[model samples]
Target: MTIYVNGRFLTQPTSGVQRFAREILTALDRELCQSPALRDRLGPIEVLVPQKVEAPGWRRFGLRHVPGGRGHLWEQGALWRASRDGVLVSLGNSGPLLHRAHVLCLHDANLWEIPQAYSARYRLWHRALRPRLARRAAALLTVSRHSATALAAQLHLAEDRFRIVANSAGHMLRLPSAPGVPARYGLTPGGYFLSVGNRSPNKNLRALIAAHAACGSKVPPLVLVGGEVPGIATQATAGGGRIKMLGRVPDGDLRGLYEGASAFVFAALHEGFGIPPLEAMQLGVPVICACSGAMPEVLGDAPLWFDPNDKGDIARAMRAFAHLESGKRSAMVHSGQKQAQRYCWRESARVLAQAVAGVPYQLPAGKQAARGVFGSESRPVENLF
Candidate 1:
């Protein structure tokens, strides 16, 4: 039987979910070439993609273009029909519901956990399609245990139904940090606090800004690199440009910014497996994220945790990092890299390969762990991955 990778992620703007799909394919391709056992067990593997996508260039997974529409229409109609003979692996949340021999990696229960983040259509589609997809898939995979439990409760499935195939920060390590980024942004090395995420409701942007405002200009400036939220300009005005919103940076520049930061901050109310913190840790930057969601679980003791709901608490964490003792700050960098090292795309691919091949694989220890991570060369990535 063939194993078909769902390639719709190639078309969409990247979030953490799209990053998961891309890296899993890259690592799984590596596994097929290096591991004879896995290669033999897995017969022919192909990426069943639409005709329109600029698919990743992979040696092992052959690309088969199926003609049809785009988005969910394409995945459900064309891609589904093309891969019916084989097991379809959909790494992002959406997939063909009619296909029973499927493997899906649902990133979070965001629609249910934070309903304000999505439009009603997106929520309705996810609510309708995801549970059916999960119920029918050959394997249901998620990023972390917190996500697994949330998804199980939301989708009305058993906790045991989901498997963990984690995330990592090797992609950030892959990029040669671009030196021009700091000069272009007029940022001093180690004199800015970096927070990367979109202006979605779950990002807790309002409170994050409020905290930064409370911290005042005595601390490092707050640098936000993603889309803008409403009233952010007004908030920034209060701080006198102390909060800089440089929307959506490229991977190379992002790596540079991460390397030059005094600290990395994340204020998400919910996350399945937070990728930005992991990315920061990989670049040897200390992280301070909300104590909520998967932060405590994914980051372990590496970060100085704060409650996302409390702006005062966030202010304290921000100030704490700014005024951190040199010795303690170095300790944070030390533990953070150690924690980040625990997650590998190869190991994740091993688990995914096993699920695809009907074999059980053991997971190495650690919390879950992507890029400074990019592959497609023609177009630039604008989403917060």
Candidate 2:
């Protein structure tokens, strides 16, 4: 049978979820290319997306895009019909709720956990639809163990109903960082502390701004790069130019930002799996993050943890980061790189391959083999994976 990938995410801009889907899709393509045996078992894969939207680099992955339909109508109607002879793989959350053979990847139950973080319309739609979809899916996939736990609690599903197929920094590692890209934004290399994510309330950007203000002009300037939503503009105004909000940067420039930053700071109250800090770690940049949600679970000991709700604590973490001696800073960077190494896109693809093959899914072997599918709090990723 043909394996059809829902290309709906191609119509949306690059966010954490879209990034995860793209990386996984491309890596799966690469896996099929490198492994003839696996490809022979899974059959051929094709992309079914909307014709109205621009295909985002699908050609490079050797993806055959059969463009038709429009949006949700396409996903629930045309895509479902197309899957009559195939297994539909909907990698980004929503899909045809009634399609039993469709595999669903629900990144997080963010709307249920942090209602204020989303718009009323967005929240309403997700709340009404996600649970129904989750209940009907053939196979459920999620990004982190933290997310799986939260989702299981919300949907009343068994933990094993969802498989955790984590994200990787491999794509960022492959991108070439232009030397002049940081300068294009008037940022001096290694002269700034970086934060990247949507400016939603649950992101706790206001607290980050307050903490940056608390730093009292001694710390590096804070660079905010992500979607420039209305909720963030007001809190950002309090920065008095100490914070630069450059919304939605190009991939090359984003790489430069990661490469040039002294440290990456993430203060989000929740995440399915926070990717920016991992990207920073991949670039050999140190990270300071709030010890909440999956940040600690995914980051391990690589970041300087702080209380996201406490601005003073955030300030203390920043000060601690700044006051760290060069040797200590170097050690943190090294640790971060080591931590970042645990996530591999190819490994994620291997897990997806097993799911597609109707075999028992197993996480790809890492340097350490003792790790569970999702590393436990007691074991570091290096020891677990």
Candidate 3:
């Protein structure tokens, strides 16, 4: 079977979606290649990727040579043609062709929920493309049960059409705490709370900053890692001490920050599946996150929860995490570690391959014609094994 995976997201910085695409594809290529069940049922699998990506190491899953230009027109055309042979799976927002038997990994509906987080042009593009992509998809994949439910509710998609595959921590599972990292970032050792992610409006960073200031002297300094620092407003506080913005730290440094922090903080108003909190958990750091979207689903009772809308609530959560005794902190860390183990890339790949292999070749009404290069399934769409 030929599987064309949209690898565009892989080019982005290491984040939830990029990591998902890269890790899952790598795992599938390595593990599924030797699976007797997959081999016997699906025959030899052919994976297609963008041509510009290097194929020697880590890039070999599928690279194809599509012309690079404005608006991704050439790449989309290439994907459409390549997908003609068999099932196509898009790992991001964009889809390849109109009528192919395809699977779409719609990570979240963040654009619709928080339009202010994105620019007008981005929102317009999403509004135009998302519905068409969702309607055309043979099966929809999401990063969390929360995301699955949200997509179904927002897009009015049938429950059975969606598949929930949670995101997992990357291969760098753990990071040892380095003593001088705090000093390098001009922070006291074990005297700061860590927050990581892009500086988009949905991150609710302004609220976090307000909450951190409201905590007064009891809470440690707030260290924000990742995203470009906005030049418009001064992030520094009234006392000249501000939320330390360490924009886009290297992976090793990020791990150090996570390990050495008093607690990990996430203030996002929405997320498909929050991964940074899980990463912090693996690093033995206690987490404090907003009690909404996939945050509660991902963290459960493992992390300290606060309402994103209430600055006082966020401050309270921060103070609680900051003042917790060593024994209590240790317990939270252990619980978080156990919770983090629930997600894995290998299982994600297995389920994804199953979904793609099981999709019927016959295209549905208003959907594109499914080329019969692959055999049909005797079982119903809901009952495919």
Give the clashing residue pairs of candidate 2, or none.
371-384
* Pairs of residues clashing in candidate 3: 49-62, 49-63, 49-64, 50-64, 51-64, 51-65, 99-368
| C-alpha TM-score for every candidate | 0.89, 0.88, 0.87
**Best model number under TM-score:** 1
In candidate 3, residue 328 scores what lDDT?
92
Better of 1 and 3 by TM-score: 1
C-alpha RMSD values across all candidates: 9.0, 7.6, 4.1
Residue 205's C-alpha lDDT in candidate 2? 90
Highest lDDT: give the candidate number: 1
**Which consecutive 10 residues in model 3 have the weakest lDDT in total?**
230-239
Total backbone clashes of candidate 1, pairs 3 or more residues apart or in separate chains? 4
| Residues 295-317 of candidate 1: C-alpha lDDT, one tens digit per residue | 78889999998999989999999
State the lDDT of candidate 3 residue by residue for 144-211, as single tens digits: 88888888888888756788877887554634446577778778767888998877777888899999
* Candidate 2 ranges beyond 4 A from true positions: 52-69, 228-240, 359-385
The superposed Cα distance between candidate 2 and the true structure at residue 252, in angstroms, equals 0.6
Error of 3 at 241 (Å): 1.4
